[model samples]
Target: MHRMKEFYLVSDRHIRYAMMKAFFDARMIEGSSVREHGVMMLSLVEKLKDLQADFNKEETYVDVILQSLPPSFDQCIMNYNMNWLEKNLHELINMLV
Candidate 1:
């Protein structure tokens, strides 16, 4: 039973790591391409948190999301307030979605 639990734990960690890598490595898809992927990735992130995954900080995740945005978002990025950016990342994500 203990070994089975350990195996499950390792498997969960591996899955979480894979998802995180995929999200970070991904570029912004053209049009609405990233919306679905973003939603799925965000869901996976929330799920991994439930499993006690040592996820990256939300600020870093926000930065990654911002960077993944297309050139059209450059204006918004330039206008972004770093403090508000950290606090209102969901708003930014919603805009993209």
Candidate 2:
């Protein structure tokens, strides 16, 4: 039983790590709209949540989404940083769209 528990824990950790990597490495394709990209990121976040990953929804998740944006959005990213804007996932998506 103890070994079984250990195996499950390890499995969960691996799964969590893969999910986190996917979230961080996600990028907006050239043809994709901001809304589509944002939704994909949000879906990854939800999967991480289901795995009980320890992350701040408002900070880590939002930052990952922003950073995953393409170079075309550099100006938007700059504006958000320069103004110190605090936006949630949905709000950020709407703004980008």
Candidate 3:
């Protein structure tokens, strides 16, 4: 039973690592709408939550989405930072779209 528990913990850790990697590596492809990208990112967040991963939804996820945007969004990103804007994922997606 102890070995089984250890194996499960290790498996869970591996799954969490893979999910975190995917979340960080996510990038908005050209021609994709901001809404689609945001939704996909949000989905990954939800999955991570289910796995009990520790993450700051307000900042980390938002930053990840912003960083994932292509160069075409540089102006928008600058404006957001310049204005000290605080927007949730859904709100940011709406603004970008």
Candidate 4:
């Protein structure tokens, strides 16, 4: 049996900006140690950069549909919260497991 991983190449600044805005707007109690705000910001920024890359590149870094700017779990867990890492930590771990 084999499993495949999904990839996405989001090319919209609006989506990226929305995600950032939502995050800042969300006011949730969070655990400081478990979550690293800097890393998450970096990852999202990198995603935005990738989205801004040439649409007609010889070798594309991205190779899948851009669902959400930065894809999230199913609907049940969608929200704009600064403590995204803590809130969605389990969801992410579940994906790996």
Model 1 lDDT tens row, 1-97: 2364487765766666766776677666657565675676566556556656644677666677777777877777776743354444456567666
| Candidate 3 wrongly placed segments (more than 4 Å) | 1-10
Candidate 3 per-residue lDDT over residues 4-89, each given as its tens digit: 44777667677778888999999999888878888888888877887789675577878888999999999999999899999977
**Which residue pairs in candidate 1 have backbone atoms (N, alpha carbon, C) closer than 3 angstroms, thus clashing?**
none
Q: Summarize candidate 4's per-residue lDDT along 1-97 as a digit string, tens digits.
A: 0111123344355555655554334332233321343345335445545545333541121111112223332242343223343323334424322
TM-score of 3: 0.82
Q: Summarize candidate 2's per-residue lDDT along 1-97 as a digit string, tens digits.
A: 2364487765777787888999989989876788888888888888888888958556788788989998899999999989999988788888989
TM-score of each: 0.63, 0.82, 0.82, 0.27
Off by over 4 Å in 2: 1-10
Model 1 spans > 4 angstroms off: 1-10, 33-37, 81-84
Cα lDDT computed for each candidate against the true fold: 0.64, 0.83, 0.83, 0.35
